[model samples]
Target: MKRFATLMLAFALVLGAISGAQAATIKAKGQWAFDFSWLDSGDFTSQDDDGNSDDDFSASQRFRTQVDVIASEALKGVVFFEVGTTVWGRTDGALGTDGKSVEVRRSYIDWIVPNTDVKVRMGLQGLSLPGAVAPSSMVFDDDVAGLTVSYAINDNVGVTALWARPVDASGNEGSDNNTYDEVDMFALVVPVTLDGFKITPYGAYASVGKDANFTGVTNGGAEFLSGMLSMTEFANGAIDSSSSTYDAWWGGAAFEMTYFAPFSLKMDAVYGSKTADDDAESAERSGWIVAALAEYKLDMVTPGILAWYGSGEDDDLDNGSERMPSVSPTGWGVTSFGYPGSVYRQDTYFGLNGAGTWAVGLQLADISFMENLSHVFRLVYMKGTNDADVIKNNAGVRDAFTPGNTYVFLTDEDSAIEVNFDTTYKIYENLSLVVEMGWIKLDMDEDTWADQDFSDAKKLVFNFVYDF
Candidate 1:
């Protein structure tokens, strides 16, 4: 903690000196949050960690700040720093508080062409694929080193192009001889707006070297891709060791309609496919997913319905998975227990992806019956689309479907229901307090899971936040 403070002071002094010597303007924004939480049956299992149950109770805090140095309207440099999801009494939050926990979340620059309307962003930055019906996304969404070029053709039309390198193992051991140990991606998006309707269509492509280091990826992507690469049940090895590369592609469109006052509708549909060089029949996977949301705004609240469906694995493993592949999924769910997009400063268990499942939900948001206070309530039910035999008939795949992972692999006979209630109170212009309650009832067919049993999950959270 002391080191962090000293570093911050030195950084501020350097910035102040630079500002004094230049005409650039300096601006800053940040957030500080603390949370207290209680959770039970989070993993839906009875496993204990060194005699302690999987359930948890704890307090944690986080801090983030972004600074921008602007030379003019056309050029600027930005840097964002983050510290901790540090739990009380843990490493960085312990009595001495001497842990090294600072991270550079983003460092980028924005510039525009001198005589054209073209804009460019370069460096480490946050990026997301276009999607409707949620603040997060089911496809790629995270901070990555990349370059983006955008042009506004007119008020109603625009286009953007991007290129990113998610993994590069150029100098690593065993990588010197192989130039194919990297992953590169490219994408394009076109957005159109007319009247009260809007839509965005996008397409993305990636080249994955056979020896690509998935560890360099973030947001649960590493695990998902690693799982796909290691499935050995298929004939002659799912993804042959001799395969040189894999090609992956995705196409999607997001639509929004607000032509009718107080009523709004949003939808997204996407398809993705990945194929390995070797013709191992099961070396390829392809599928699709669609999601929609509808809401009606009233004087007291906004009532909404949300739904989604995604292709899942079929009965035959030899044909590979029918489920859609995602690089980094951050889908928002209606209920906190199922998706937890609405919760603040609280760690959640459910994987944000809606892949391999179908769900329906209803929510009442912005329910305010008292001054300075508001509430939101949601209920959702979900069922898996994958065949039960995918796991029941293959014992080798069971270890990969454990509860320790970020996302759960469910079969056709698996279902779950989730409920969430959230309350918020504005204590000051820049500070607020929030409380969240959530529960989930998970059911897995006994016939398919055999001796495996899962318990219900519940959680309660309280948070204090300040923004500047």
Candidate 2:
């Protein structure tokens, strides 16, 4: 706490001194937000049996605050600072044990170039891929010290290049002791406009430290190095290794077009691949996701339809191969709507999602009822093909166990019907009260182990903001 205070004080002093010399204008912005949620469950455990466990209930709360300062034209620079904290929680083991603590979320600076379409930004900043909605399989939101440069090639096209570190070290549970030095990121984004429609195409690559061991054996094992150099020997030996690092790359193209007739459309396709180092006996895996959304605007309501399809890697047994795993939400990635246990990854040669596979859904209405109040209602359903069971038992028996001692199971046919309602009212020009209610039902085949039932989850939030 003292360290944080001291850092803030020092930053303020530096800013004051710089501004006083140049007679620059000083602008400040701040925001505060609070969120609370309640949950009701019936047999929420990930176990396979419909055990008559107790019907449990729990609630949690969170708070966040941020401040930013911008220098005047004379100084030609911008500075930002953010801090957030979770106030209460009992649903998760980590949060339930030790309470929350406040910590710095972001601090960054930017300097505008004197001429041309170029600017340099350094310090902590947010990173996102080029997509309307991030894939549930890919992680989102990394904060790192980096720089970005933008250039306007012409009236219709622009490009941006960026480099940053991989770190999401916010003051949250599981964030302590998180460190990475050999990991780096780079990206290129290009936007072109034509006939009132914009097309964005981007690509990004990350090279992380070597942490994945593909040999199926640890360094202490005699067969470890042998497994890496020769897959034939690896197949014959008993291999077990710790997690290591490697390089991962992703690229995508997207189009957003709007006609003057009150309708807009968005579509995107992305491909991701991971390359392991020599010590890791793992094979290169690749996957892709395609999504499309169309929306029509009415006087008081908007309606939209969304469709998404994701393909997993093919299984190759001869190469000591397995299907590529879906990405997990370790930090601020995609979150489950109301599922009981944390949904990590899905296995399939093609069509796998954190929620499910090959989802075709529609949202009927998003309406504004009264002044400063609105409502959103959506109905979406997903289906899985070559499904994979996510639950694991103590004995390591799965829906389908591979000869290599890997568990690759499939879920029976499953579906979820969800309805969400949200309302917001302004308390002042910059403050508001927000409330959301969600009801979900999971339907699965009788033999499946999931808690196939219906339930309601509620969230209430209040926020105050002064934007510059």
Per-residue CA lDDT of model 1 for 217-275, tens digit only, reads 44444534633443342222234546778888899998999999699999989998878
Expressed as tens digits, the lDDT of each residue in 120-199 for candidate 2 is 67776655555553332232334456778777888999898898764332324353223322446788889888985877
After superposition, which runs of candidate 2 have C-alpha atoms over 4 Å from their true positions?
Answer: 1-24, 46-66, 72-84, 88-100, 133-139, 167-181, 212-245, 279-283, 313-356, 385-412, 445-468
Error of 1 at 400 (Å): 1.1
Cα displacement (Å) at residue 446, model 1: 1.0
lDDT (CA) per prediction: 0.78, 0.47
Worst 10 residues of 1 by lDDT: 230-239
- The TM-score between candidate 2 and the true structure equals 0.68
The TM-score leader among the candidates is 1
